[model samples]
Every structure is written in C-alpha cells, then in structure tokens.
Target: MRFALSAFAALSLSSAAFANTLESSAGALNITPMVTGLDAPWAVDFVPDGGFLVTERDGDLIYIADGTATRVAGVPDVAARGQGGLLDVTVAQDFAQTREIFLTYAKPQSRGAGTALTVARFSEDGTALENSREIFEAAPGFSGGRHFGSRVVEAQDGTLFVTIGDRGNRPSAQDRSNHNGAVVRINRDGSVPDDNPFVGQSNVQPEIWSYGHRNPQGAGLDLEGRLWTSEHGAQGGDEVNLVQRGANFGWPVISYGEHYGGGRIGEGTEKAGMEQPAYYWDPSMAPSGLMVYSGALWPEWRGDIFVGSLKFDYISRLDGGGVTEVEQIEGDATSRVRDIVEASDGSIWFVSVGDGAIYRITPG
Candidate 1:
C-alpha cells in the first residue's frame, strides 16, 4: 500500500526524475528523496530512534520507519478545510521518558474552526498514538478558511509556543482579548504559565506570548533560545520576526507590503510602540517552516536561519543574525517547499507540497 524509496536508490535517480543536485554557496548538495507518495504533507519531525513522523493536511499521521510509511491512529479530528487542517508535529522534549508528542491543527469549533494544540503519546510499537488530548485552542474560532498559523515549537524551558494567525481578521491581531493573530505559550498540560506576558491581566488572554501578526506559518528557536517567526504578507510584505515577550508586531496597522491590489497598508509601515521585522521580503517569497541550524553538518553555516518558500519553490538561508538573506537553495526537487528540518545526523530534510514527498539534503 506504500512505496518507500531508500536513500541509496534515491541518490541513483536520474535528473529526469527530480533535481538531484543543487549548488549553494556552501557547496554542491545532493537532494535525495527520503519518502514519496505523501498527500500534501505539511510538517516533518524525527523521532528519537531511526524513524520520523509526518502530518498530512488531510489529517493522517504517518510514521516513516526503515523507509516505510505507516498510518498511525489516534489523530484528533481536524477541520480539514481550505488552509485549515493538520499542520505541525513536534516530538516532545522529554519524549524518551514520556513518549509524548505535540501537534497543531485547525480544530473544529462551534463558530467554525480555530488553531489548536494537542498532546498525544506515541505507543511503544510506534504504530499508533494513545491518550490523545487537546491542550489549547485559539479563541473565537473564525469561519474563514485562511490564515491558521499553527506551528508548534518546544522552548528551551520545555514550554510549548504555538503561533496563531490573524485568521484574516486584521483588527484582531491587536486585540488582546482573543488568541487570534497571536503567538501563545502554555504548559504541556494546557495551563497558563504564571510568568506569561499577559497573565493576571483582567481582560487579556494569558496564553498570548506576542500579538499583531498576519499569517505566521513558520516558527523556531535560535541557538540562544530566542523565538523567531516567518509571516505572510498580502502582496509583498512577508516577514521574519524575532519574537519577544509581550511585543506587538504591527500587522494590518503597518506592513511593508500593500494590500492585494496596489494600496497603502497601515500608517506607511512604521508605527509607534510596534516592533519592526528582523527581515522582510518585499515581493513575497511566501515563507513557511523555519529552522535554526546548529551547523551539525556544516559548521560554516551555524546559527543561520533556514526558511522554505512556498511561492518561490526554494529554501532561503538567512544569516547575519537572521536579518539578511545570504543564499537561496533552489532546485526542481524543492517544489513548493513546505517545511524544513534538520535530522540528528545533520542532514537537512524538507517537505515539498508540489511533489507530495519529502527530500533530504546533504553535502555532496
């Protein structure tokens, strides 16, 4: 029922099959297919052992072991509508001891659907998930099918940081009363951390770590444990932000890009008390899936930020402390790059929506 291509076999595939090699500033890279036959895979995360987990937007959690794909049971029901579905999957920090994993998806709700976080246990046999539990759900679910920024990141302190988009509602990003257009922080048990930015506030949602964002689809932590996010702009204002506690990222109120049609957006891009982006793409690269490289394989590229571009079909390597675009790794295999992650062995892996498969990159 599944086709699994081994790495050795993938390396032997001719250029006619896929882009076999890419030339980056670092060197020539061999792009090999790690797994194929995925249906709109959104995110990929490695397990402690030799296997990995992948989430399909259609709501299947597939575990890839020894080059085979097996559907794992116990995934929570997802909205599975336009732009809303199974999103990101992350292995828990204490996975070895707790066997826990985290997932972010568009959860069905009364008003419509909202981004939600769920905790589940990966059974010992790695074929099924057990004890699945919904931990957090963004507030005031919207009916729109766009902008569910649901990337899950495990912070250094073991807390989970989940990004929520503006849900196509501009003003809500600035409103603290709801989780819309916000990056929320919560404990694994779904409880608000006492030190959260808005905690104890009378009207604010305590889970919000930061607010005022459009559709931030990518998020990660740097070597220093600082949080960062990649966001989509309307026409040309995509952004990469260095997330901070209680900081307000001016979304609709200020943007480097204009609306869909040519028109000004938000006070000409600068506003008082609003944080500016670390880096932005004026022509809209449509960035998604962020990763802070440890340089495990390429020491020279340590501390660089790698982001997949859905619009450009390439991987962007940002350096100069995440404020500059140093290199663009592009190839036919990088079609509609959705998510990019580093494996334990230092190989870089990414999901391709256009190809409906996963590929790994290594120094050639």
Candidate 2:
C-alpha cells in the first residue's frame, strides 16, 4: 500500500502540474509542454528561422527543428557518464550569416576520466558539423563528475563569456592560475581579450574575467548589455549575480549554505574582497537556466529574472532587490530543467534534463 500510494502521488502531481496558468496583473501566462520524449536534454538554443537546437546529454547528439532528433555526425566522443557529456549550446550572434554555433561538453580522455568543460564551434549542414573546431578547454581537468559550469554568452562587441565550474573542488575556485571556477572572456577567434582581468598576470590564464564560482549553469545578458549568472550552490546557497569584470565571487571561502550533511561550508558568508550575491536561496532551488524577461506576455515581469528550478521543480520570478515570486509550473517537478531561452516571438522555452522535453510559457 505504501508503494502504491507513492506511485499514485507521483502520477497525480505530474498530471496536475504539467500544464499551468498564471494570471497576474500584467497578463496571463500559459505554460504548455511543447515537445516531449527527449532523453536528458541539456540545453536549448534558438535558431534564427524559428527553430531550435537542443542537446541531449546521455544521447550525445544535437536535436534540431521541432521534436526531430538528428545526430550531428561530427560531434566529438564524450564521457557521457555521471554529470558529464553534451551540455550547453548557443547560437552565435551572427549565426544567420555564418551558420556558426557554440557547444559545451565533457571531453573524454584516458582511463575513463575526463575534463568537464570544452567549447567548440560548428556549422549547421543538417547532418554533420562543418569546420568544427574546439575553441576552449578547461585546464587540469578535475577527477569528479559534478559541477561543469558550462554556459556561453556572446556580447555585442563579439566577445564570448564562458563560465567554468569548480569541479566540486572548492579550493580550486580561488586559484587564479586555473580555468576552473572562472568566467572567461575571449574573442570570437578564441583569443583572450586585452581587457580581461588577468591578461598580464604571470600565472593566470589571460582569458579569465572573473573568478571564484561554483557551478554557474545559467548566463545571459540584459537589455543594458550587462551579464548575469545563476549558479548552483552546495545545499542552499544558490545565487544570482551580476557579472562584473575582475570581480571575485567567493565560493568555498564564503557560502550561505551549509554542507550537505548540515555543517557550515566555509569560514563565513561574507568576505571583504569578494562580491556579494544579488540574490540567494537558503534551501536551494537548484537553479539551472536563467533569462531576463522583456516580453509582452507578462509586461510586469519585464526586466525581471526568470530562473528554472531543478530540485524544487518550479520557475522563480525574481525582481530587483532580491524579491522573488515563485510559480509552481506543471511538469517541472518530475523534470530537471536544464536551460531556458526566450524566443524572438516573445515565448519562453525551457528544456528538461530528465526526459529532454521542450516547454513553452506564453500568455494565456
């Protein structure tokens, strides 16, 4: 009877929340499941012509256009085990003209061990990657399976910002010489920008823009061209931060969350030189994808941050000064949301890490 009750509860929750409606002062939000049957979709990127490129982690392929899952033939072999494999995907700023797309994944090395972060560019030809080349790779890859910190954003000046995870090694976040736990800025041609924080530092990687981060899975630019990131914390210190150049975002050194077993994570929650988070969740919403909503579907939500929660299974609406309004969306409770992107037509699209379904939230 206990097992039966648990199963019934799961079914009821899944059925009730898979479709949701939000009636707010600005307007109504109708969230609908767009496409389903994906196997651990990791990221979703919008194409110029109203289609999308979706990455499936365990499957090691990029799915394109509607629910059609096509294996891009030239994708490199990935160590698709335990928090690794194909991750984030983003279209280049000049994607329409160049057909260039950026991808992040865990590149497999010897002994079944692998580095968690690598970025590459490929051209879209419907079947295989054309002129694909790796542009960035994490140095001294860690041994564990968690915290890849893979998100790519292109600035208006043609600079790329790539977030790297701390690889579950807290102390590595404070090391300026490594690529792990840092946000790196580079030109489209994979050259470090002169203005990068550590461009002239002796031991530091010139590409590093900012350092001391955990797992920054979500990154996007706002209307003002300022970069923003949402990162996963140990247990409760999930954070939303405004990315600033040369900023030190304290990770293991300072965290609001306790360790997984309920002990303090670091020395304190505040340090002198590190930048404080704009917002943090005590119980950890396990935030993944982030987007600043400027669409007409919910005018009041304009300039607000929309974050997808993986563990809590909801979408959090965050406003200025850390005020948050959480809406329990349907289907997310059973699905781990990997990424969220706003379409050019003002619709919000989200992908699940569990089954790789694509969902859209629009005005009802």
Model 1 lDDT-worst window of ten:
1-10
Candidate 1: misplaced stretches above 4 Å?
1-19
The residue-level lDDT of candidate 2 at 6 comes to 18
lDDT of 2: 0.75
Error of 2 at 148 (Å): 0.6
The total number of steric clashes, by the backbone 3 Å criterion, in model 1 comes to 0
Model 1: per-residue Cα lDDT at residue 284: 99
lDDT of 2 by residue, 1-364 (tens): 0012113233334534566776644566676665566678888888786567778776455545543445666676676778888888888888778777787787765533333333344544455667776777777647777777778888989898888888778899899877878888888878888888788879888889999999898998887888999999998999999999999999889999889888887778998999999889988989898888775666666788878888867767777445465444544323677788888878888886664477777766
lDDT of 1 by residue, 135-226 (tens): 99988657888899979999999899999998888988999999999999999899999999989899899999999999999999989999
- At residue 312, give the lDDT of candidate 1: 92
| Candidate 1, position 281, lDDT | 96
What TM value does model 2 have?
0.88
| Top candidate by lDDT | 1
